[model samples]
Target: MRIFRKITTPSNYHHHQLRSYVSTCRAVVLPSFGGADKLQLRSDVPVPPLKPNHVLVRTRAVSVNPLDTRMRSGYGRSIFEPLLPLILGRDVSGEVAAVGESVRSVIVGQEVFGALHPTAVRGTYTDYAILSDDEVTPKPTSLSHVEASAIPFAALTAWRALKSTARISEGQRILIVGGGGAVGFAAIQIAVAAGCNVATTCGSQSVDRILAVGAEQAVDYVAEDVELAIKGKFDAVLDTIGVPETERMGINFLKRGGHYMTLQGEAASLTDRFGLAIGLPAATTFLLKRQIQYRYSHGIEYSWTFMRADIEGLIEIRKLCEAGKMKIPVDKTFPITQVKEAHEAKDNKLIPGKVVLELD
Candidate 1:
């Protein structure tokens, strides 16, 4: 926000004698358009500068997500252009490199992590990244940087989907399809912590891991049909996989007036009423109606959740981690130079847990 000295120079020595030097770092760049394996290696891109309400982070680790793969393949060309040879990543855990004049709360050299909207700022694939002060939270001391980097995107999406849309209540029966995935696993943990009974669908290999994360019952999706195996009506259903048929199957499983939340697909909107709940009733009527509907017929309510990166939300996740209420599932980490492999692993769901990029 404030600049003491601003000059363009070929090297730090040309401008000052004692400026902190952290150049010669490696970063993954998408040179033009290509597949994940082709993410070019660029070693000289300057670490971006800090802005007011922004802090520069010395990235210790950055995680791979589905979006990273898309970005690497030029799938986001419309939104991420004039391309600028962008770096692709979402989750970041690292120490603060520098702070802007107006920045507060986070100080230099403190460890922190969050989901960085790289298209807006710059991606976390680089060794250092400039972050909005509002998008980061102090890292829990109990978590390694790799562990912390794994949670931001998946954990936050899970939290918002359950807390904001489902309003999970005590004794509520919730069904989470695709509970083996990162976001789904996180939802299971948060739901159990909320005093709700959870049932999730995962492959046989992942069933134990899903249960370990707190699901009351793990459905072997490959072996059994979720709708047929789980007979009791649910208060809420989280369809994370969002297959058209999957959504259709889960829709009728909800108790009348119950809510359906999805991370993908637009097939069903939450605004529609089903069964005896025939109107857009007031809050009280809807709650009462849902309670009443549970007594007789099933209801279908749906939502497509869009996630945001918020500091307070990340702080809450940090607290949960410290209390042992949240789990960070990271299966593999690749060096910054191997970013292409990291993206591929995430895209193919080859890793059981989150994938990360380790930086120097």
Candidate 2:
């Protein structure tokens, strides 16, 4: 008679299975911050093991933001220069390939669209992107991957300013400066969805779209004097331009105790200039001075807002997209192999709006 032997399965069996499926994937890496040519396409970038709360997305599409191009051209050198060879993208629309042991919100093969936080190091400019469960949500069935990818980062930024920072409510008046851009247009729609009356400044070409989205007033910044044209005080003002001129107008338009937010926070820029040791403290002190000055003199709150990952906000945005109430039209798209060209278009302002990269 022959001896028989049996072996029990290993305790870490699940992780073993996942790693086998995602040992490596394709990605676009930026070894150094420079022009569009600095971005490189790599075939076998290593995929690290997923943490228990994270999910692995097999990316199909990713939209380019101004941040992506800025980072490529050395925007956050203080933080990013040390961590070179980073994959540079934030917005992603794709299907889940694998989930961590504790992930329950989504299962493998589920279609999802979401964005990473602005400071995330490992981005979505790759075949596989790792995101926490809260950062990914079910994709809106009404939109394609390319179209869906265009919405998240911009919409989330708008949501942060209006809904989270400003606390805008129904029947209140909101002013959005530079409504022709993605974040500005999203703000207009978001405030409208919240049942607030909205007024915005945009170019003549964007007037119809702005009005169609339910903005009560559309003042062309180029053709009209915005201050003279727009009537009455607003409960909140979101200044996308963030220039001295727009900033002054935004603060002046607000009601007492109303909030005024600008997207151009100086935290990162200061850090890039002075390095993290001294720059971070300087940025915080500067922000405090402005906040106090506005509170005392204008009887309003002033803030520098940035995009943050919020699950509730992402789910609500999906509902808006599904209902055809929120959208960001894509100006153009390029395959992942043509990422350089896509980035070049953004830098050159060849396309007026969003640019997306597609992967096969």
Top TM-score prediction, candidate number: 2
Q: Model 1: C-alpha RMSD to truth? A: 8.2
lDDT of 1 by residue, 85-161 (tens): 77777788999876665666787779998887535536788877767888788988999999999888888888888
Please give the distance, in angstroms, between residue 341's alpha carbon in candidate 2 and its true position after superposition: 0.8
For model 1, what is the error of residue 356's alpha carbon versus the real structure, in angstroms, after optimal superposition?
Answer: 1.3
Flag regions of model 2 displaced more than 4 Å.
1-20
Tell me the TM-score of each prediction against the true structure. Answer: 0.82, 0.94
Candidate 1 pairs with clashing backbones: 255-299, 256-298, 256-299
Per-model C-alpha lDDT, please?
Answer: 0.74, 0.91
What are the RMSD figures for all models against the true structure?
8.2, 5.0
